[model samples]
Target: MSLYFFARSLVYVIFKPLYRIKITGLEHFPKEGAVLLCSNHIDNFDPPVVGITSPRKVHFMAKAEAFKLPILGKLLPDLGAFPVRRGMSDREALRVGLKILKEGNVLGLFPEGTRSRNGELGQGLSGAGFFALRSDALIVPCAIIGPYKAFRSLKVVYGKPVNIDELRARKASADETTELIMKEIQNLLEKNR
Candidate 1:
């Protein structure tokens, strides 16, 4: 936990001036309770940017490959991130994420599952929706706008909680819920950009 905060603060101090990072809609972030903070992934820095800006400690699902790195591998879990294998069904990763939400902690997800190659919003994968349905966590859609260049302004915008209570009450599928979550994220990107 201390390492997480220390890394977070370090990112803020280093990236704030270099990127001129600006975040809005932070008020939409809930102060407590189980929350799924879903966002559009754009670059390698997106996770840290969201983590630093969020009021809560975000446990992110990092790529399994990253865990093989000499230093980052050892540090990711300490920073509350677990590994998820891409291009395959990684049930263990899903269980870990759901447990985080069930414990009333924030779990960060990139609905796109990977960074967008075009800097445009891509379709959301079902991870965020799956967690939301299983844990009833609030889905707060966030948009990250950046090419991530030095001295260039970068922005993170948070949208209001997506209203999925009706869908959940009706026992909707995860894919359908994901569509709604992605729609909200796209709206944020369009509005802010």
Candidate 2:
């Protein structure tokens, strides 16, 4: 197996027992074609948790700052994480994300852009919508609950894909699409709460 798959397997083996991870809605995931997995950012562990729980391989956009570390910088890319500069428009990152989708791969993102320090869902950014629109990828809203604690049970819920075509036909802007995505995530979180 590739390093990425190996690492993901290791994460699943370790965290599944430690956190008692429970995943739902795997049936909602597309069997093939491009997909955009959007979820709330609770902490650094959010990415790995989502990645491991997902039915498909997920390529995540991590903050460029995280790539500055010597060892981690070299390893993250192998683990399906690409650098994205926060607080500014990073066209290169956007292009990379779009490319991943166009190549028929799953691209994972946190619509909130950054981790929620208080563990509450925050306002989502427009980047997720932008990528969805640009790549014509299905947006799968995901909710991850109780991942902060290593010994506590953690849950991940994957909602049905958002109707992007209908939303676009309604003249929904990127920000509006992002809001819709966040709403779906919130609903999923509430259902599992």
TM-scores for every candidate against the unseen true structure:
0.97, 0.96
Alpha-carbon lDDT of model 2: 0.90
Model 2 lDDT per residue over 73-159, tens place:
999999999999989999999999999999999999999988898888999999987887777788999999885576888889999
Which candidate number has the best TM-score?
1
Deviation of model 1 at 111, angstroms: 1.1
Question: Model 2, which residues run further than 4 Å from truth?
Answer: none
Native-vs-model 1 lDDT? 0.91
User: Cα RMSD for candidate 2?
Assistant: 1.1
Give the Cα error of residue 137 in candidate 1, in Å.
0.7
In model 1, the Cα lDDT at residue 95 comes to 97
Q: What is the lDDT of residue 50 in candidate 1?
A: 95
Go through the candidates in order and give each one's C-alpha lDDT.
0.91, 0.90
lDDT of 1 by residue, 96-147 (tens): 9989998989999998988899998888787777888998789899999997
